[model samples]
Target chain A: MSWLTRAGAAAAVKRNRRAPLLILLLAAVFALAVPRPAPDHVPFGEQQNVETANPLLCVHTLLENEVQEAKIKRSLVLARELGATTIVQFFPWAYHEPSKGRFNWERADRILGHANRQGLQVIARLGLVPAWARPSGPDQPSTLNYLPAESFEDFARYAAAFARRYAEAVKALIIWNEPNLSFEWGYRQVDPAAYARLLRVSYEQVKAANPDMQVLAGALAPTLERRGSAAGLNELEYLSAMYRQGAGDVFDALAIHTYGFRDPPAAEPNRERLNFRRAELLREVMIAHGDGDKPAFITEFGWNDHPRWTSAVRPSQRSAYTIRAYDYAKSNWDWLESLCLWALRYPADLLSYPDNFTLVSADFSKKPIYFALQDYSRQRARSEALWLPPPLDG
Target chain B: MAAAAAGWLKRPIALGLAMLALGAIVAAALVAIIRHAAPPDVRTAFPAGEIVVGVDGSFPPFALDDGETLQGLDIDLARAIARDIDLPARFLNIGYYALHDALISGRVDLLISALRVDPARMDDLRYTASYFDNGFVLITDADDSDANFDALKEARIAYEYASSAESQIRDWEEDGRQLMRRPYELPQYALDALRLEQADAAIVDATTFRLYQSAHMDWSAKSEFISHDPYAIALRIDRVDAWKLVDSALAALKESGELAKIIDRWL
Candidate 1:
């Protein structure tokens, strides 16, 4: 070979040997220069399954936007300590699937994992469509609850994935929240058939994903609006219409939102007055539809005591009425599964009348209702134990 | 290379140019560091040259709309505060429930409604000193010799049935004070009982008493606040400078007796 050619080949061999070392030095410098995120600390260990004494006591936990893991764990622990076996938590589809097909399960997993560890059975309410799922039609405003007709399958797919992912922890799933209210129905005219279709699609998908999951439908808000009103349809008429659309066969259990606005639980139910016993009217509608075999769940029911709100009761009345309502449910309502109170706590101040309905403050301070219910649950447990038949002699 | 650099530095023109470049770089870096290290300006919490105040016009005496114009004690007090701060005051009539949201969402710079200072909202809102007390007070006829509760131990006291005043009277009875408690259907009726000689004294809220006294000048309020629920102005907690300015203005008004004049004008 020529001398120049030989020299070039030797130089190339030397450069190739130094290339990896140079790249390694550069990688080390880059690693030292950039900041790395702190390692994630799993807040909870494996949850111990402990059954609660009061099966009738349930609370709606406002953990949908609670970002802190420690706070989430503490809220669930308090609920379990209050003898609540079931907690109706909102697992919004928009939160989990922010993008079309991509799913971020970090927040959901943290909440579900803590709830499971606290031995709280979750009734996951699924709704709240993502912005991407909302249609870009000129007539529809980009709102939180605006889910167009085409996005039903997309929502169902999210529900199926959520059910399948947390089937072991969450056995009950509420399809939608207060569909009878115009605010919840994307501000469109309240259509029972449309909600029924949404429920049917979700029920089929969830059941297909996890056959053991109990699908709850019809979280109708109690309104006194008559037919053809712009606000909403009366919850009873809406449920009746839902039945007419063959919604009874789709859902495993019926979900009802029965609020005791200013009346006591024993106040007789009327077509015009909204009260706690209004759930009875809903249950009667279910029975008349021949779906009496299915259990009805009070998904949202409570009284607010905000002094300025016209519909609020006194604080003392709220405590007394809440206990009385629970007792009445236990003694009278045989067809009911659980009476989940409207809310346990909020992550922040809602600055509205709904703030007065919470059992605990946003900072996790237990309110009077929390202690009153805890005392009532303990007493009921003792009473039930006393009534238990003596153990048979082996 | 070392000899060449020394030769280049030996020339006065080149050395001056190099030193100038170095000084420029240093000055640029110093400016950048100072800009980065300075604390962010916080006066941007509210819009400039305007002080927006939210008032619930439904509350009478404190803030109410009189057909064509909004007139109340709170309205005048807010205007005075605006004058003191040298800013134009724009009042937004918000509902009582939406008052907190409006302030927090920056829809209004502050609130002058008859909002009680809620401890739960302290984290989100910064409250100035109470402008008025809307709690229950003992009221008697203008000529009653035993005007205060302490002096009227054996006298009959009337309160609205199932009202907070009744509860307070009961609590006092439990504390070993023998009070002849009389009940009326409404607070106005309870005050009317005192006027009509049906009862020696009547316990009613300050708002009710103010409205009643404004209508019938024969009744008079006595005693220190029985149930202390003071109405205060609220602003977003982040508006430190604005809150300081408004709070100082309120303090000056209170010091100058202008607040008392405003309260007396409406009450």
Candidate 2:
């Protein structure tokens, strides 16, 4: 329709060959300047369900920090491959809602989409205070975790939005993580009553949005700090305090954080000791509170194997204890719904002891623990040794 | 004076040279003024007159509590930094995860916990220039011909099974560099395999390699980093004065070779 437009451009280019080069240069610059999405992860394209003999096997995934879609998909794919039927992923309020009323669900949508395609059930763990919700002043230097009481309603609003948006893909919503620790409570005095109030508010809001979505309370951290300690109150005391504050009615299930530390899976737990079986002490507290019928989920549990870290076990023992812990939970804890590991993998290595908690490395290399758990989940017998006995023969 | 000035101004060459010289002098003066004007009030930067340092004292060769007191490279570095800042230093043995909290809460002035400089924490914190690299490295025997990466074309590489070294090997393979991988249960085992000449090369983090070498001082090996995980100090972003002073102290340490001596004393 416009022959002169194209003809004139061709005639001008012929007149000045540098024009074509200049045009190409401009094109290259434009291409480079335009922001590009991380190479879009091609989904599995077919519906896939996790094939597992133990549905209690779950892993908390730190995918909120992942910047690439391909890595997110790969992590979820690995979780599915490991026979994990459920994953506990954080949906930070700060990340989703940077402003008071605004919301950004781009990353959450991608994660849920991939999880759905992989047939993985996601339990969204929500926390972290946005800038608008956090108190700011010259003297008050607050962290992202410094959630004020006034912002509890704002966080509930965010949790409600998240539940409503991904109700189909997500199975449950865990409100807050490790609130028993003072550090998780923004360096303030640990308050169990305050946490229960936040939970109650969030629970009502989330249920109103998606009644089918189960709300879990108190992914309380396991600590030894007593009632007067500045660091934190122990989870047992904190849970009791929550129950007294009427937290038992607000949440449908309980979320607990326990670790094996240096203890074996069968190690007996005591009031003064911490181990894998410390979860039982938490359950007993629930029973005393007359909430024993409510199901519990161990949202964060694992053993660290860092060589220099004081509380860590050996790599072999970490693997053995993890599998044993899963088995023990499946056989003994009928009230427990899921026993999730502390982490699946970090988006990047922290280059510290905490890195030992992951089943996969930052680069996606499956650890021996991953293999061991895969074997346990798939019910495959390990006939061969993991490695050569040693170089002792030399 | 007027006659002399007029005479000098009449000579175009002399006039041009004089103006250029004046301009250079003015520029140098301005640079000196800017650099020296903001001598941070140490009283305001560190009101306690002591640098309270937060460190996870569990990591040996960096910082470890020997049931009496914390000592190691990080501890020494913190003491040296406080000395350079003209303040007495107090140390708090803290958990690794709580290091940042202690700093931000004003409970501690700074953190030197062998922490990798994470970009995500930059929003609320500022990190000093790297003091050490603890990344994965390819270690080969001193006498081995494959000390250089050239032999990786046909090398049987040993590394801790499922560790960062193993992941680095996988990354190399994905980049079209084929490697014969031998994964041991631990990095020490991989180092042992290399020392025994069972493998052409072994890969492990620099910290592990150093600790192993320290245990076997007679064993000679050469290592080069395949990836970089730099450890640095962190301060709250709002503490501009403290950040500036600490950064300069680190630079001074590097310049005087004191930093290298401190690193060598442990690593």
Best by lDDT: 2
Q: How does residue B94 of candidate 1 score in lDDT?
A: 60
State which candidate has the highest TM-score.
2
Give the CA lDDT, 0 to 100, for residue A110 in model 1: 88
Please give, for residues A252-334, the per-residue lDDT of candidate 1 as tens digits: 98888888888998999998899999899998998999998889889889998764455678665787899899889989999
DockQ of all models, two decimals each: 0.03, 0.44
Model 2 bad stretches (over 4 Å): A1-44, A383-386, B1-39, B66-68, B144-146, B171-179, B255-257
lDDT of model 2 at residue A188? 85
Per-residue lDDT tens digits of candidate 1, residues B118-153? 887798889999988888888876666657767768
Candidate 2 local lDDT, A1-394, one digit each (tens) = 3656888978876868777888999999999999987666666568889999989989999999798888998999999999999999998888899888899998888888888899899899999888789877758877667889998999999999998998898999999888877778887889999999999999999999999999999998888889988888999999999999999999999998889999999999887888989999999999999998999999989999987787888888999999899878878999999999978999987888898999998888787789899999888988976664445526
TM-score of predicted chain B versus true chain B for each candidate: 0.79, 0.85
Candidate 2: give the clashing pairs: none
Task: Please state the error at residue B221 of candidate 1 in Å.
Answer: 12
